[model samples]
Target: MEMVRELASKKAAVIFTKSSCCMCHSIKALFYELGASPTVHELDQDANGREIEWALRSLGCNPAVPAVFIGGQFVGSAKDVISLHLDGSLKQMLINAKAIWF
Candidate 1:
């Protein structure tokens, strides 16, 4: 949990992902398209991956990989991200989180 919190607070936008997960790829692409350079943690390749995943689950994330955190807050899964984007709130969220300058 401490590691997860540290990583989350290390950047304005952070994503815990697995390399082979398509949803993770989609989310990464989404941040790129939005002009935000998010810090990505590839769980599959990390020594503490499983621990972090479990920590994320305890924090209320389901299927934890691809878990998104902005401004130290859990932003949910791909569905939630898409919804925020479609609703035009994602941009502001990024700005508020200090993830993007524009």
Candidate 2:
């Protein structure tokens, strides 16, 4: 409902990750466990991944694997995501994404 509406109103959420990146997989797994499936933009596969890497770097963030964004807001890397979950803030984020939680 509200979360789905908010996600639909946004442009897109991109996740920059590589195949061997453990943090990338962890974030994806966490999202799955939370029931919020995000659109991943794998930097290792997309031809424009380099450009995305550049964009993230320009934002004063290191071009690291598992970078995330929702509604164009930078959400940081996998450790950041885990911290959000551990701190109980991830629920709000999932709510905004219209995710059906367990």
Candidate 3:
């Protein structure tokens, strides 16, 4: 969890993912399309991947991979992100975090 906190806060927007996950790819694309550069951590490719995955699960991320943090806060998974986008809040969050500019 500490490592998650450290890594998540390293940038305005962060996404913990696995290289092969399609959902992860979509979410990353969403951020990019919105003009936000997010810090992406590919757990499956990291040395502490397994442990970090455990921490994400413990933090309530179920299947985990696409865990997202915005403004250094644990926001949620792909569904949540899509919901936020539909409601027009995701863009606001990106702006607030300075991950995107108006």
For all predictions, the C-alpha RMSD in Å is: 0.8, 5.8, 0.6
Which stretches in model 2 have alpha-carbon errors above 4 Å? 1-13
lDDT of each: 0.93, 0.67, 0.95
**What value does the lDDT take at residue 92 in candidate 1?**
97
Stretches of candidate 3 exceeding 4 Å from the true structure: none
Residue-level lDDT of model 3, residues 1-102, one tens digit each, is 899999999899999999999999999999999999899999999999999999999989998979999999999999999999999999999999999999
Compared with the true structure, what per-residue lDDT tens digits does model 1 show for residues 1-102?
999999998899999999999999999999999999999999999999999999999987788878999998889888889899999998899999989986
Is candidate 1 or 3 superior in lDDT?
Answer: 3
Task: Give TM per candidate.
Answer: 0.96, 0.76, 0.98
Clashes of each: 0, 2, 0
Query: Residue 86 of candidate 3: its Cα lDDT?
Result: 96
